[model samples]
Target: MSPALDVRRPALAHAPLLADPVAAALQAWVHADGVGVAAIDPDLADTAAFVEAYGVASDASANCVVVGGRRDGVERIAACVVLATTRADVNGIVRRALDVRKASFLPMDRAVELTGMEYGGITPIGLPADWLLLVDEAVTLAGRVIVGSGLRRSKIEVPGADLARLPRATVVPGLGRPVG
Candidate 1:
């Protein structure tokens, strides 16, 4: 295992299990389209947990990343991609690629308002039309993967190969190693 992955969010076993919005949004898509879908609830946000969430032997899960960028002097929000075992280097890749002066995580309220998904569930599937999406090469390697449901209560497992079918999504290698 990569040492980078070793520094993951520890599972608070006693902490109440919570809902995931990303999961819910993905499930909704599955039902509307009748696509085979499943949800992987992890006890923690660590790499190991995510790997377990997708039922992959290793880091096979895709990442549903959120980013905050300032465009035209206004703060805008976007989501990016990376392998679940990897992380989003938002400060470097997101900011430079988007040409934004300042980039940070979108505030909870703003993230919810823009994505129409509840906090913790933001997904790129039905994101704002103008919102920029930078899909990673690693994500496309997998036929299918799990992402945020736009709600913390659930997650959306979908076909990664067919992501471009959605309008206004640009597939690129914006995914990078996290600077955290």
Candidate 2:
């Protein structure tokens, strides 16, 4: 069980609380032994509110942010998973990684449209196959982490090691830096 949540097995067990892609990913997860799901008030889905209301450690929460850039007129996109206590280094490391002249957070509508997920509820698990998934090394060492279920009404908990094994996931050291 999570520190303060009624975590249950098989994220697919709560299909109504997850986005279609999220549910599908859970269904196919090979190393899902420790993966769990927990329902939450939709309004508390944001990281800070969820942590304060549920008493989960900040470090145990991972936020997935979508970033995009263009290189030679071609668009490149990536999803970055970072611990809530820190922020992705988009302008520095991420920009260079994408080999783009500049990197910026994708607009909300575009992100939602591209990932088929609600705003504030985009998780790395079910991202589009073509997009890169960049996970912070810190997140991989965080034990169990709380990530979005692709819906504002629930969260998915999985061992950090399992996250690094997701398709297209690349563990990047220093991808996240402490937030000020």
Best by lDDT: 2
TM-score of each: 0.67, 0.95
Give Cα-based local distance difference scores for all models. Answer: 0.56, 0.90
**Candidate 2 off by > 4 Å:** 1-4
Model 1 reaches what TM-score against the true structure?
0.67
For candidate 1, write residues 56-120 as lDDT tens digits: 54345566666877777876666786666667778787887678887887777867776666555
Structure candidate 2, residue pairs in collision: none
Number of backbone collisions per candidate: 29, 0
> In terms of TM-score, how similar is model 2 to the real structure?
0.95
